[model samples]
Target chain A: MLGRGEIAIVGAAETTQLGAIPGMSQIMLHADAALNAMADAGLKPSDIDGVACVGPMMPQQIAHYLGITPKWVDGTGVGGCSFMLHVRHAAAAIHAGYANTILITHGESGKSRINATPRPPEPESLNGQFEAPFGPFGPPTLFPIPVLRYMKTHGVTHEDLATVAVVQREWAGKNPRAMFRDPITVDDVLNSRMIAYPFRILQCCLVTDGGGALILTKSDRAKDFPTRPVYILGTGESVETNMVSQMADFTSSRAFRVAGPTAIEAAGIDRKDVDHLMIYDAFAHLPLYGLEDLGFCKPGEAAGFIREGNTRPGGKLPLNTNGGGLSYTHTGMYGMFALQESVRQMRGTAPAQVPGAKISVCHGVGGMFSASGTIVFSNERP
Target chain B: MLAPGRAKPKPTPETKHFWDGCKQGKLLLQRCGDTGKAYFPPRPFSPYTGTRNVSVFEASGRATLHSYVIHHRPVPGFTPPYAIAVVELEEGPRMMTNIVECEQTPEALQLDMRLEIAFTPMDEEITLPLFRPAKGGR
Candidate 1:
């Protein structure tokens, strides 16, 4: 458990601009995020002894770009959730006295890049033989199939899924870093151009080219730093299957069901103690399914919960305070944003801060809900 | 030249029986001879008991519509405006298949709706097992 260690988030930073930045390479974006995060923690580049990254990005590439060599390096590619999982790894590494300060980073340029040639998957890559043959090539299409299944099982309408987009857009209106700040109505969501059925343009997240980074160190060490430290209370990770087609339940994610309990147990807290939530919302329906699988709501009741405004601002539980991937920026790796939002909430720095947020839960699902990572954060460490 | 429909999925020696059953409009699942536990994406060996003597058995195509969504996007082979559903078979296996011969609307899809297998021939070597609302389109 991360709580057994002394790790805490001392700094966080995200690229100021999301969406199309024509000139910058992915490495530049990563370096920019790293520099800003170090500056936010009031630490120099030499202070970081560890580096971790998620997805297809390379850790050595980022290290070279930053002009620093980390003693410990990990390039865990567990899809979008890899960064949250890295927090746990960092905690263990720090407790083992391997590294005192660690930097977890992510960067991607999904949009504004046209491939003259399609990059082939590695011969041994899990996706190479299993999924590429099927038509669910991208994350957007892969998730919609399950979203449709959820809608059918729960009697959730397209408008119900749109409600998620509408609420996030409302939250984005307050966030200057959000990619789309304009207010949108549920009708607008329904009327938006359809990418996949039941999923309109609004329901899908934007393909913004950006980066985010976080700095983690011992809680005692963070006291010397300028910013308040958000202690990592617990962390859990689980994977059901590598391929989407092999999963037993398409609508219900096994990863969340398995990882959520472990996280809550590791945190030594009950579900009622969580004050805010930062669930990965690669698509609007993901968080809804996540909430159900995490036991926040009963099966087939997430749509009703969202319809009653339980997840909006001033609701019982405010979610995605940074506006989430739907309205914010989804750099393919959405776990970075979830952790960033949780840290902001714990430190009382969120644009839409929940009052007296003592404990917060951040969750991320990687690769079509096949893998899940959950972490619980607290303002005070035991 | 490429054909206009779903390409035939080549079944290896392990999966040939499963695809053959689908062509016959029979849902076939592999059950371990030792444990009698059914599994899907048919394997030559049983995962439960690690038994090599896995037996292929005809499964009751009757199932409940566990969940579904209507997709407007067209894939390489599937047409636009198709409904993909996750059906929980009577034998406790779940699989993804398309729903046909029913209006693709939320009101039309009810949870736990009873469905029966409907096979559609895609090409010479491929036959997909789809589902439609049972009897009265329920």
Candidate 2:
């Protein structure tokens, strides 16, 4: 229960150029986002005392390159959801007086794939021994294992899958920063080249090079910052299983069920209290799972729920208002962008602003349901 | 020679026997004597009882299709539009594998269809256990 109004995100910013920038290295994206966030906060490197980041590099290296010595740092790398966990941990640290002005950063060249190094899992390890030999290449290939099963069990059709992609592009059309802004239809998705079964090019997220950073400090000290503080209402993090096959249920992520409710409960609010929502849409099926597992809809009902247009811009929920990873900048780890949207919606500065939106629940997944982190943000303080 | 990027499972302390069973043209699963919980993807100890005492037992090598995808993307050692699938073994655990010896299409690849194991030799030391439609399945 971390939402006692103890810590807040004072500043947040994404890299200036999100699409293909061949000149920028992975570390450069990180540094760029860090500088942009500091500039957004009207603070210098000297004002930061803590750091958190995820990539091939170390936090100390980022701190050194930024010319700041962090009194506290965290490299909680569980894929994309790593930054959400960092924000939670930083909040706890800020409350405990471990450090002040904590900075969390994320940068990845998911398309460029520059400077990304994943240590090969031990052949004896769980995935290496059993799962890897099957040749599920990447997220595009592997993630479908459970999603396909989910579609079958839920009786979700290809039309339903395409509808998810179609509606997301509607949101992307409003975002000048979104990469693919051409208005697309459900048939456009159903007819696209199949990267994996049931996943066309449109149903998947974009591969771009991007970075983002957020600054957290004590809530009492937040008024001094140039930007309005987006108060942290609650945060929750959990892991389901390392392998997709081992997940307790293919239709829903146990991790999401655990983390999502935990955050809403910690904030002491009901699901309806969430005025704006940002569920990590690494693929179309994710939001469906997030909606069901987060208890917005019952199991197997999210497909029809989205079909009825409840999550569209004018709809009740306004999910993935940033166009989502499906159309927005998804540099492999998409949680950072999702978190940024929640911050923007709370600040009333979103490109597609939800009118009078106060509370936002942003959920993210790490691997193929390998891990999850939920964050609840509010414009109001407790 | 196999394709350039096939990930050959390097057997470890807990998994050596499972690979060994595949090499010997048999399917293996680990069972705990303490809690009677059967598990796949061998481990050093039983997940149910947490006991170090476990033994390998032969499986029927028969399974039913739990789920599948006709992966249109290219994978290492595989051509596009190949079927990658998960099968629920008779022993009651699912394994990720490739379905072979049949056309990779929705008409041919049905869920919950009965299937049997077929081993492909990746190398002299490693053999992959692939599945194909059982005689009665279309």
Candidate 3:
């Protein structure tokens, strides 16, 4: 798989301000993060030969805007996890001599709706024909469709789901940049207003305005960068179904089952080697599913594993130390923020850094468990 | 006004029969002639084999609740709260539908409850095949 650690992330940074960036348009958020990442590595846009971003035809838009003439470009917008796929594709392209330095950027004016184009329902499309007639407002309604089935089959209680958010907020409480830093209890989560059945408002991710960017290059030249290189040990990306209703299984993610193992195997590491982790918490139920699907716990055991204080700070596995999408700022597509946390943890620069954490596994979800991408990072040169 | 302001499905060449069947009070599913697998949201070819040799047939319109969410937000035509459900058809294909003539509450809407299709015409151009509690079943 292109040899482990062949590609290294030399530069990584988010926009100057994250929470409410009404001042920046969607495209400008991308540019702001790109410029910051470039400055972090002591490089200019002229040094980058490859560019990638979310959505179709966006690579050309971002590359041209940054005044870069890229030889390799990728616009693999599967969903929120599209940035994870971009990192995987960029690494392969750099190794294949397609480009020297590759840049991946993510920006969404989710809260401000600045120059944001809301997708109109297509009556002629498959979703419009079958699923849309039932009245799903968006991710809040659509993503939770399978949770009742999951809870029934797994014997998971509502309190188990609330624990996922409660623990992540514990991590968020340590970060000054987190959107919600106050300590929250499981009762507090349950008492919050219900947006959907079995899911309180605290369980859902925040819609914020932010962006993040990353710069990847060959590990052989990693020493030349100003920032410490976070080596890309392995990456895997896969999609199960575009329609959430068509998912093969409601309790487990097929995409997560495929991507997580593929990445861990590609890195040739066991579960114990991963000291820190970031599972995209678009909702509280996601972390429960991710933990099981990624082989951290057996089927139906993740809820209890999380409830037992295993993933909290000073626990065996510190997960979502940046508060994750639950407490951290989620700008629609949260994969970039997850990757940024992983890079920070590996470099020992995270706001709530895991002590001596060498390997960090970052797993992300797109849409309603529609797609998944798992990336394994290590500070140690493999 | 039958379901005013609701987004209606625009049938494509391959999916026309399914919509047409709903108008005539029938639930049609596409089955691959080569593999004998019945599928939903009709497509021309089999998803398993990619063969266009497929046939359309009337389904029994019987399904069991696979999963659902009670959305509490107001949408275009739906009320403040409604059950958006996915039902596992007896033929093995699952589809997203709504449960009608029932209270939209967890106490009332039980998982794995038997359901039967009740086609409601949204407009002259489209008819939605919704489901309700099956008669003479659990």
lDDT at A215, model 1: 93
Q: Write the residue-wise lDDT of candidate 2 on A89-181 in tens digits.
A: 999988877898998988887778788665655666888767777777778877777776788899999999899888888898999999988
Give model 2's docking category.
medium
Weakest 10 consecutive residues of candidate 2 chain A by summed lDDT: A115-124
DockQ for candidate 3: 0.86
DockQ rank order? 3, 2, 1
Tens-place lDDT per residue, model 1, A294-317, is: 888899888888889888888888
- For residue B87, model 1's alpha carbon misses the true position, in angstroms, by 3.6
Candidate 1 TM-score over all chains jointly: 0.86
Give the C-alpha lDDT of model 2: 0.87
Instruction: Supply fnat for every model shown.
Output: 0.31, 0.70, 0.83
RMSD of 1: 3.6
CA error at residue A312 for candidate 3, angstroms: 0.2
Put down candidate 3 lDDT per residue, A96-120, tens digits, no spaces: 9999999999888999989876875
